[model samples]
Target: MITDMTQGNPTKTIIKFAFPFLVGNLFQQLYNIVDSVVVGRFIGTDALAAVGSSFMIMNFFSFVIIGLCMGSSAVYSFFFGKKDYVSLRKSVFISFFSIGIFTIVLSILIILNTNNMLLLIKTPQSILEGSQDYLEIIFGGLIFVFLFNACSALIRSVGDSKTPLYFLILSAAINIVLDLVFVVEFNMNVEGVAIATVIAQAVSSILCFIYAFIKIPLIRLHREDMVFDREISTMVAKYSILTSLQQSIMTFGMVCVQGIVNTFGPDTIAAFTAAGKIDSIAYLPVQDFGNAFSTYIAQNKGAKNNERIHEGVKSAARTIIVFCLVLSTLIFINSENLMRIFVKANESNVINLGVEYLTIISVFYMLIGFLFMFYGYFRGIGALNISLVLTVISLGTRVLMAYVLSSIPTLGQRGIWWSVPLGWALADSVGLIIYKRLK
Candidate 1:
């Protein structure tokens, strides 16, 4: 199950490793996408709007955990490539304890202030109670989120991407079934979807943990492995905190934009939500490919295979460009139909708004594609700060442009749509320049 990236053609190896990641992430996105569809169709527009808006907040916290796990996974890949089992074991121990504690503290704070947090985001009064209830239930599953991400990261670090995919497929199926049961059959509404998500997350986390302990010897910890080494801890903190900050900042920017979207009322919110999910699913292949590329680069870097790393950069670029172009064309052509899947066909206003957003954003998928490649490359090379800087540039531009352009009488919400690609173009430019200099 463990494939070595240090051997084989750069393109083939990276693609093979990345395919499972792409599939797994799709299933993962289904957790949110299914929630939105179920609520929007069965419940009502306001319910859909509440779930959609709440997603911005939930995504922020979820990315924090993802970033931490991703950062630590880079460390694991490096150690594994170096064949330093001792250091790998130590890192596994350090990251698990450190991120675990952080998740607990964060969950407590967020749960305690759920209502206040919703108010701060300027959630509309009509959807405020629903958002609060949804978030509160979702937050209760943070530990499960932490556990699942941590275990999967450790497993994938050693090049076993397929194992994680298996678990995610199972969990996603469970989530879909539960969503129907709770929301449609039992009529639990927004709260029903929230509970289903948490339960699904718990199932995946528990199964992933058991698999890691039984199957991945490198992840198994002895009592002696639990002892903290200051050196390893510092390295772990550097990768985890910086990556977490980068991810949190990026999502925080979305949270700000969500506040702006909230001002436009429930229709816009519902449309934006559906469009955003489709956008995420559309571009996810490239994103997951970037992550897989990172692991490939990390392992090569660890093995001192600089030549392979360089080759990988080129291979990844070509793959991303082709994939993004094809995906963009598909989404642009099918925007309206995709929207109808989430919103009712009779809800022409919501579908049309979502279609407009998609058409505007789809053509620029390559820009974000290139940006993700740069992010993965930087993270792989331990240039965590560079990744963080690129994120700030992209998301900062997004938040700023979104506010300024949207305020224009002529531009309005279209400005928000236009701002996304502008941010992507800016970040891609900077990333390409930096990579050139580094080369």
Candidate 2:
């Protein structure tokens, strides 16, 4: 199922890869979305808020793993494009073991300090215990999250996006079923959904690891390949650490914003949670397409197909603009209805707030779309520092503006909403200028 993007029409090949990746990303998002829905509908607003708040923290850690894996996969794709099988296998061994140890250490630290982390985020007392319980259970699955993302990244590096999608579909289905069984039948509350998510993640991670070893000969590590080379290790560290920092910093800013949102109490917290899920789902296609474009560019870069990479940038930009326009219209029109999905119709205040957040941000999807493309492009070309700089600009603006604008009495929470697109716009403008200069 491995594809060579260096040889195809850039637009067609990128879309072909992105379609499955987009679906897989959707299923991946479902792991969290279903948890919120089940907890919200079955438990209560407090429980929903608890899960939502804890999610921002959890997302911070999970994205660290994702960024590391994604960064390493660029190296994998480069080697694959060059037919450097020996070095590729060695990298697999190095990245797997190195990141695996890091995940273990991180899991223990996060688990032990769960309460303090929540407190630092200004988690209100009313939902503190629920958030702690949810987070503790979720932290136990960090290794699984690392494993699944690592395997998926490696698989996708060689253009086998469909394989990972299959596993995600299976796992997402299991997560939905388990969410119902545990929350509705057992009435386990927030803890129930958290446990369901962990179990589902375990399924996906274990299955993916097994599939990669048995089916992808390129990825299978032999005894000799297990020995690390200093050069490869250095390369992996440079790419992985920079990318991980970028991803974590981006989420960390959200955690900071979540702290601000926490100040508004549980209603705003719940509304933000629901609205955030809708926003992610709405823009996920363009985001995943950006990821696909990264893989395409990485392969072409390895093969020294500079002209094709330029064509891909143009092709991806056009596709993203059209897609964003359609998505913006759909989300803007159905904002209220989407809010109602995660919250009850009776919760008028929560629904209205969520609608407000969506209406303001949904119209600006193209800005984030371009930003994602730039992140992908820079990372693909081994410009990890550029990606990090762009993320800092984008997220730093968001966090600082969210605090400053939200503090003004007139702007209030609406200020927080508007700050997002403003950050995206600034980042996109900078990214476009940098890319042009690179060209």
Model 2, 1-439: lDDT tens digits are 9999898788999999999999999998987799889888899899999998899999999999888999899999989888798998999999999999999999999999999999999999999999999999999999999999999999999999999999999999999999999989988979888898899999999999999999998788899999879999998999899999999999999999999999999999999999999999999999899889889988989899899999999999999999999999999999999999999889999999999999999999999999999998998898989999899999999999999999999999999998999899898888989999999
Clashes (backbone N, CA, C under 3 Å), per candidate, total 0, 0
TM-score result, candidate 1: 0.99
Q: List the residue pairs that clash in candidate 2.
A: none
lDDT per residue for candidate 1 within 1-439, as digits (tens), equals 8878999999999999999998999999997899999999999999999998899999999899989999999999999999998889999999999899999999999999988888898899999999999999999999999999999999999999999999999999999999999999998979999999999999999999999988777668888888789998998999999999999999999999999888888999999999999999999998898899999999999999999999999999999889988999999899988999999988999998999999999999999889889989999999999999999999999999999999999988899999999999999999989998998
lDDT of each: 0.93, 0.93
Cα miss at 194, model 2 (Å)? 0.7
